[model samples]
Target chain A: MSKKQTKEITESTIILPEDIKKEYTILNLGPTHPATHGIFQNILKMDGEKIVEAESTVGYIHRAFEKLAERKAYYQITPYTDRLNYCSAPLNNLGWHMAVEKLIGAEIPKRVQYMRVIIMELARIIDHIICNSVIGVDTGALTGFVYMFQQREFVYDIFEEICGARLTTNIGRIGGFERDFSPKVWKKIEQFLKEFPKVLAEFESLFVRNRIFMDRTIGCGAISAEKALSYGFTGPNLRATGIDYDVRVMNPYSSYEDFDFIIPVGTQGDTYDRFMVREEEMKQSLSIIRQALDKMPEGPFHADLPEFYLPEKQDVYSKMEALIYQFKIVMGENDVPVGEIYHAIEAANGELGFYIISDGGRTPYRLHFRRPCFIYYQAYTEMIKGAMLSDAILTMSSLNVIAGELDA
Target chain B: MLISQSVQEKLINEINEHFQDALVKHEVLYDMFTITLKREAVAPLIRHLYNHEEFKFKFLTNLCGLHYPNQKNQELGLMYQLHSFENNYRIRIKTFFPINDPVIATVTDIFNAANWMERQEYDFFGIEFKGHPNLKRILNVDDMTIFPMRKEYPAEDQARKDKNDIMFGR
Candidate 1:
């Protein structure tokens, strides 16, 4: 968010003489301005209120998670993935865990699969609520944004019950969950399931049919399905373009095949379609969570790989063998496999892929995170080429470009 | 959807007939078939898959680069993941190059999404995406010379004088 880079980048454009006939005026939309929701800079050439051209610059918050992943052991990298999309940290954690589990060829149980489905669906709901309500807030519907945000807090309460943290949740293990869902946690999820739909219905009642909101969003920042596909969109953004390419449905990982759900898609890839797709997805997510909970199997939560997972506290204290294994696991002394693997999941935003190259060592040789934000953000200048400047903000919010994921 | 036996054989046969000179090997890892080839043949193969009716790899899932220092001349490699929306099958293409001159034909013309991804690859691994439209820098600052993702640089900041290896148990 430094002003230095903004001035440095825009120096050439701003120095033009005012007396000369100029059709467009250059404007720094922001590196530090509000409405971006994160540290981002878009130098826009504006013709009155319309954007003639837009050049986006990211990497303000690039912590280099890929480089960091190379130095850490398999389990140690879980906490780092949490920061990628902080709005839906648990999903990122789950994706990273499943990727490493694929590399290790570990066998996860049915109960663990159901638990992960429930947790990830909750994350998808929370992520969509944020995007949709923020869309309302951006379009001047403050009450609906506030109402949905209040409901989002309840979703956070569910996350807090599942994991200890709220924003950057470092939850789940490689093979499965760190711990099983307790009865109290299940009660909270049940309570959330019962209470959230009313608030969501109230939220929908306020905006879905409203004239002013519809006018502002429809046909604004629209892109064709072909362009969206060429730009490498996935998840809700690509679903808004009427392409049903979900990672879960296409490639079922960890027993996603057992659950029953429908993939919601929208006809036009505009702000309205993206918002409505997210709205319908929240309902589908509710159905998935209900199915997962109703048929929740009973078994061990974590996988049976003692070399990867730490032993129970009771066993670690009582048995010397358990203590030795736990010590070796923590210190990165375990034998990892030698192979090249690519694993992806439908993250809250899109397809988040982790490409790992292992040389039979404790640490990965090369770990590249195919971050969706980094790919889709490239198409921003094209999306907002000739649209109004305000619609640029709408398109960005609808796309849900997390800075952590964008710059990782 | 699961890369059926006949489709896999057809893909291999097509590559064997046309791109035999550039083909290195093909193996299945994590249940997805990965085809390794020479670096120069990547863009041509990507174009072929998109245009051919039998393959229909219309959507590019991802494009990234990696460095393996142990492989003497083949230190840098690029990986492309393509997905067909209709058939619901996936294929991965990997190509290796020498670190001293890591260059590959750009696929920006075939897949417009490759523009920034190639720039990111260039920014991190220093792999030149020849013929890229605006291949400058996407993520990192423009003035940076060193490719920070290579094995030469340490993960932690070397300027951190206060940190100790004892704290990290190194």
Candidate 2:
């Protein structure tokens, strides 16, 4: 227990000089850190301020969405999908509805398609607004986040008008929308369209040319195009890496083929490129929304599939067929054909896909959500390997790793 | 650039020719081509598809596991959805194996993205990836022994007996 005994023990241990010199500090970034933006944890092995190695730990909020989907009816699963990218809940809802529509072979009307396009574009705009502005917030500029959040609230108001909910707006039905966009909703949309562009321009101007912002993000956490693709990156992240593989463009569903928009790309695949790509994409989404509004098709909003689409309350009370249809749907007794279908949508984050396998049952036999956040999150350790700890935080914010989607 | 029916047939034929009998069954449903292949053929077939001159599915869009307890020996299955941006084609490659021996070769060598996906599959369905560098529970607790996604495991708690599925017509 004395100094002489300690010296003897150290002499016998045979410690290498390199081992002492290369000693690394282990830093736990978060299970609940403010910078993580979500509930996931990152264990970083560091040498002073530089991250030597990084390991990401997720599933702090794993709700077993797939297993839950197996028990719920086809329509019942839409609400769960809403929780997956809560920033753009309507996209998930529509994606699930479209998957069911694909399985049921329900021909969605042109009006329904246009309505979906409008809502989806709106969702895309708000999602990008959040991601790009958060990148600003991470780079020490809080003004943009505060500025753009008001626009997000306006978008949420539109969603609330469409569905009676805000955050997890289970907006649409399997066959089509639960109801058509009310006049008030249309007015809100028009208002948003009229105002959002100017606000977006103002937000972009705040950070796009700021010297400090550029210095923090331009070369920080860059990934090669091949590396990004190999890591299964999609949506804005993949497009930021210069591969223009958008699910909406490649496999157009809900009449995306009818719309005209350009996919924005970036060269460096760094934080700056990602922010720029998203910024340009927001503009494109605004244009797409304008187009959808200009070319709005006039027809029945909901499809004629009574079994999947719930009947009106008055009709259910009066008509026998409507009552039966309502009963069947509410009781989850609607016959779903045994089939396997994978429906992918260009969700705000990436390619959010629903892989559903039905077995002629009331519920899906097996359901898997190809959550883009979960797919892209695996690349985090590789991306942040040797970067500074602060740069690692910026990379995460730019990546927009939503814990709900990641753990779903 | 939707891949035409003839082009889909050609891709199927090429897959058949390249892997020869490893291709179990292929079908075009809802304009999406899906092929069920032998378990051993998955990694090589994926590699071949990745490097193919035409219909090069260089990008893996999704990977997940499925459980079919009533499928006798083929109780566990893995689905790999690949995409070719150039061809604008998406192909779903599925393979099944016995649940008792839920082991398959890892595709991380071909696609780095497959690392977490394979681990997730392992976590949910207990499908062990043979060459996975880090095979562990991802979205679930590390100490948890059961694969929660398998058909044998009930989605809800077993203790909840008050509500009956039959009463709800499920």
Candidate 3:
């Protein structure tokens, strides 16, 4: 055993020197975190408790939906829309279908338009209930979340009864809804409308004047009107900054002009203002739904475009023309007009727009969604900067940053 | 009511004067003008739209990438939907790039919202924004190789690969 031979061969271990002087901490805020609403991640650089910088890392729950939409026929993409912003599935479905209809120049009937308005408003209520209540839950108010969830469940029950699906409600087809609401469904919806206001009042009472909630929200995540405009922030988030703009009033897709409603605006564009704006919006939505239900016209629920719309199953077996039309529509043989149309709907979050380009084919040449969550999320860093870590959670919840809509 | 025909004509004249030899086409439908700028002129034109006091399209409402497989000369198009709250008018600034190299200047400085939208466009179509501060895959993972929105990359082609390989890679 010479000196070289006698040396013990220790297990090779590479101990990399840590950057001890760099006083930065990284926090991974989950692809499955509670505040995210869906699978999303944020890589946060922190100095003690303050976020120095945060980079949002999305795509954990991306369905490659836009690409998937390109592959499927126009009708097939309705379900995919449901996956995006599933909390408000009907609105997404309607927005996508309306975009397709606009591209093809398919005339939607007045009754169908009224029905769309009703369903979309209902979807807005469901979305707001979840959004407002989730903010409450995150801010240490648990009872309000339960109450709002109960109300949301009631709305989901209505959806299930009407469309045969709850979360992924592929309710509407290209020209119109899949089916007409039966008298019983209408009655149930009327009942829901009647009961919902009281529940909303209760929900409001829980958080509206609560000192703790107000303390956590007021003056936190304050975005000014100029900043909101510069960032292209739309919906309640923009309205919270006192912008008297609503896509329903501005653009008036699906005959929203017929309805009489005021666009509620907030003075200070803070977390509390956003919440208050949404609360007022829910009231407006309830009124819209009630008005739509009372004034719903009695006519065919769908358009008369046999080539594009699906024929009844009974007619498919009995009538050869119906069968042929159905086959052609399903097989992507229908000739959609060659044009591009941008249809924007006032979704629960904001402006949910569908830009469809048709090359005289059944399938869309190109389809792009203007998801509201995407716009609101752009101000995430601006909103959360200089705020406490817990304020970030509250601010995010108040913003209602739905990952499905964001990633889509 | 917000955007007069004279404004459109004035914009066309300005663009023509600024970028000689660039082809600018306007389509009027749905009470909005979709102004198609040549690829090279898009950045400067957008810059003008932002800086110009008369037009002040301060808000970049939405930016999206469109792939037209059948179009001969202009297959890959980028549509910048701009909304001016001050003027209450909307304009679409569309530009096309060749299939091989889809490159455009990052408009994040003009409109901060373009940061994520450009990232999304890059994620889907492999469109490169030359000066984007943090241009990376947004909706797609960092390790993703193929741009999903390209005409050549069909969903089925990726579906054929193993799920684990597609997501995490082999």
CAPRI-style quality class for the chain A–B interface of candidate 1? medium
lDDT of each: 0.87, 0.89, 0.83
Off by over 4 Å in 1: A1-20, B157-170
Structure candidate 2, residue pairs in collision: none
lDDT of 2 by residue, A1-408 (tens): 655644456665897776686778999999999988889799999999999988989999999988888888888888899899998889889998998898888998999999999999999888888899888888888888887999999988888888889999988888888777889998999999899889988987898898999899998989999999999899899888898888888888989898899999999999999999999998898888889999997899889898889999999999999999999999889989889888889999999988888888999988889999999989999999889999999999999989999998
lDDT of 3 by residue, B1-170 (tens): 13678888887888888888675678775546888888888878788888888878777877999887778767888998887667777888888878777888888877778888898999888889999999888877688898888878766754454556556674
Q: Predict model 2's lDDT versus the native.
A: 0.89
User: What does DockQ give for each predicted structure?
Assistant: 0.68, 0.65, 0.51
Ranking by lDDT: 2, 1, 3
Query: Residue A389's C-alpha lDDT in candidate 2?
Result: 93
lDDT of 1 by residue, A1-408 (tens): 856654455755675667568688999977877899888999999989999988989889888888888878899998899888888988989898888888898899999888989889889999998889888988988898888887778878877877788888888887777787878889988998998899999999998899998999998878889998999988899999899888898888868888888888999999999989999999999999999989988899989998899888999999998999999999988878998788888988899888888988998888888888888888899999989988999888988888888887
DockQ winner, 2 or 3: 2
Runs off by more than 4 Å, candidate 2: A1-20, B1-3, B157-159, B162-170
Q: Which structure is stronger by lDDT: 1 or 3?
A: 1
Model with the higher lDDT, candidate 1 or 2: 2
User: How many steric overlaps are in each model, in order?
Assistant: 0, 0, 0
Number of the top lDDT candidate: 2
lDDT of 3 at A268: 92
Winner of 1 and 3 under DockQ: 1
